[model samples]
Target chain A: MKQDSESIQKMMIILSKGTLENVYAAFVLANGARMEGINADVFFTFFGLEAIHKKKLEHLHVATVGNPAMHIPTMIGGLPGMEALATSMMKKEMEKIDMPDILEFLEILTASGVKLWACKLAMDMFHYKKEDLYEGVEDIITVGDFYNKSQGPGTHILFI
Target chain B: MERTIAGNTISLNEEGYMTNFSQWTEEVGKELATEAEINMTPRHWEVIKYLQKEHQDQVALSIRRIGKSGVVDIKEFYQLFPLAPLKTATKIAGIPKPASCI
Candidate 1:
């Protein structure tokens, strides 16, 4: 069949951190690509493992320390107790935009057909098994294998 | 370079879905523009149309086999739709997030 004169490009994203900062970033990109009808995949590994862990995925919180924008509150309200203020401030910022919490974001993305993977080496070292993963995981693979799938000319690899 | 409303108005029922464009106000366009995160300009309208159309199709994909379910790659987005909202648009559209990103 003849292709439409216009079509979206395919993209692949690999995630190495499972923290809220990393996972959410991947989802945001995935959702955006999906919105434009582009295909995306997120391969999770290393510390990123927490985002996919059935027990900890939802509770995947942001890293408050050393985060660039974490100082927004301190800048406004003076330097006292900025860490506490920053956490609350971050929550508010999230809501102002209505980016779904970790689990819901994943729900929507997975339902839409984005590929989720857990790294094999990370899983073994961490003593995690297939059962330790959430519902939609693709098989975990090494960096080399992950690269092959993401190797196509049109593919976009985002390391979040 | 401007076009007038042509003195037309549309009426919507209790539900927010759009009763008629003639009855729709600039506010409606503005709201849609904000929610969709696009400028709502003529330039974007064309891209939005393409996104909606591509989303509806069931064409086969050339994606690598990954998960057991073999997640399909929709492809052809960044190039075709530049101003397309990635994370931002999903919220406005009220669609679910992708699984991998989960």
Candidate 2:
């Protein structure tokens, strides 16, 4: 065996939530992996598909309710416009830290050579067509295909 | 630690990044690029110059900013310096490795 077989060679990140925090977390991890010279691929499924949905990507919001990290009471977090307010505030903070907005981030990831794959089952459930997703997405693939793509030692699968 | 490159002693951190930007020169940069398995070309020099200028101006470097630098887009930047482009380019440019995640 090669002496460096233990080192991570690739990252297979699975994103299942539509929350802005989760989406950004997935994006940062994938991009960070590429920054380190490790291969990375993102698999978007369930509500995560919204992240690649052209019309909805820019509108993603942070989850206020059920998220104790926000520190607001559940009832208050559930109020109308609360999510938007939190999302806008979070976006401003992100911008200050040089975080790109969703649309631009997608472009950056594509240019960085991170392959983006949508879950085939999720697409059928959501009634989404190939054209509905961001142009950078490579394809809608089945779980089996994902596994096949993940072949080889040192490859890891991460679900977010 | 201090090491000799291009016949001059230079300081570097544990990660092999040059500690003092003042010690950097075209010769030193060429040596560093060779160490990183890169061949210095006019195109590569343009990126290194841009990176050094950004460092001098105190601009925090990131892939996003470099993509928007107009000196090179992200695709061309990656093509110019494959693998870890930011880390490799910055190292060859004799600047600290950027702490950017994106």
Candidate 3:
């Protein structure tokens, strides 16, 4: 007989930067892993702190200005006589995708019970007070604190 | 899965923004509508709009070239798009069910 997940197998993650894609990737993976009954931990630090900044998460910006991906939409941003038609097409295409905004993504993770942590010393350097942190932060800990959690077999650590 | 929309069929890819929400929201939205007696609003539309643009931006768009960044404040979001009397806004917004509710 096989042991249940509660008896074996653990996965963990650490998020050190707060970019839309990075956070998205981390949570998506964690959520998927959890659905499969694995453990996951995301450690937020540095620029990554932006996602946990209560005042900022809702306002987190995607890298549209200089990023190559921004060009596709604008490629059709203003076409000649077909501009209106093109605009309509763009709007239509937009409706068919399922993307969670930053704030909502965080909500989903917390809602699903994925453990989230913040680096204490990093927060100290930025002079970030805990109250400034976003809702549902599990705890604030040092690198040593995170290492303690990352121990044991099957623990996975990732900086996204 | 592929779904048919207004006049065209939309393809669901693994990479699109709100890729998860866009694919499932309308179905859930419709279910919620029937159970709760509510309708979708424009603010829900805007947040998703921002999400789509940001998703495309993710492939390569950065603020320097795209010339725009930041999300609209959530409070003002309510004013522009009013909520359903029974708190339908949260449902359409894909707001996670509250902890207590779970």
Candidate 4:
């Protein structure tokens, strides 16, 4: 399709990290894009699929393993209670800015017309059923389908 | 910088968005539209009016919100403003650049 001269009509964001910061960035950018009148979609894969999973989403943690900010050795990330501590701290900071929790943010994005998709391969590997995901997920599509749907004039594909 | 419209000095930011919206007039709108290379039409005026009102209300303006306001649908908004609808329309309407714009 031929695009209009200057408007960005479509945006595709691929979420590969379930970390709080990454998920937050994806939603912020998607919301901003939709606010600009662009059609936006987010495809969740691998660890990212956990973001849309109902049970997992509620307990999202900041990835401490291999995270340079953590400073401590990566092995410390495997210790118990670290994830819970990080999750709480992140949530507290986000609340200061009036940003909703991850689950609420996802619902707001969906209500605002941002398409959500789960990767089929990830679902199969993780054994995630459609019912296990949040209500707004459109479908379990392969990466190829994502590429095909994202193809068009002024389409922006971003991987995060 | 400023543009004199109808004997009124309308102050504008360095980026050309109006700093004082109260100084905006139809003549000023026409001049701004021309600078953006858009020929003024009633439909364009509709959007410009709506944008000005939203700015006064301190509402965050977006294409979807504009469409929901019944001023115009997203497709028609793009058609009216051509490239960069929100940016161009807001500029023509004498409002600040939308936060969503780069």
lDDT of 3 by residue, B1-102 (tens): 454544334443332112244444555445544544444456555554554454444433211111123454432332333331112333433332211110
lDDT of 2 by residue, B10-38 (tens): 99999999999999989999999998888
Q: Each candidate's chain B TM-score?
A: 0.33, 0.98, 0.32, 0.89
- In TM-score terms, candidate 2 sits at 0.97
Predicted candidate 2 versus true structure: per-residue lDDT over A84-156, tens digit per residue: 9999999999999999998999999999999999999999999999999999999999999999999988999
Q: Score the docking of each candidate (DockQ).
A: 0.10, 0.64, 0.02, 0.12
Window of ten residues with lowest summed lDDT in model 1 chain B = B59-68
lDDT per residue, candidate 1, A1-160, as tens digits?
1125354466677778855667778878887676556777888888888887889876665555656665444344445565455545666787555566676667666755678878888888999989888788878787788877776545667777
lDDT of 1 by residue, B32-101 (tens): 4564445555544444443333334632211111111222222322222234333332222222222222
For A92-140, candidate 4 gives per-residue lDDT tens digits of: 9877655777887786677567899999999999999999999989999
Which residue pairs of candidate 2 clash? none
Model 1: lDDT equals: 0.56
Candidate 4: Cα lDDT at A71: 74
lDDT of 3 by residue, A69-153 (tens): 5464554433453444543454355334444556666665564456888889889988898899877788989999889988886
TM-score for each model = 0.55, 0.97, 0.49, 0.68
Model 3: what TM-score?
A: 0.49
Report iRMS values in order. 9.5, 3.3, 14.2, 6.7
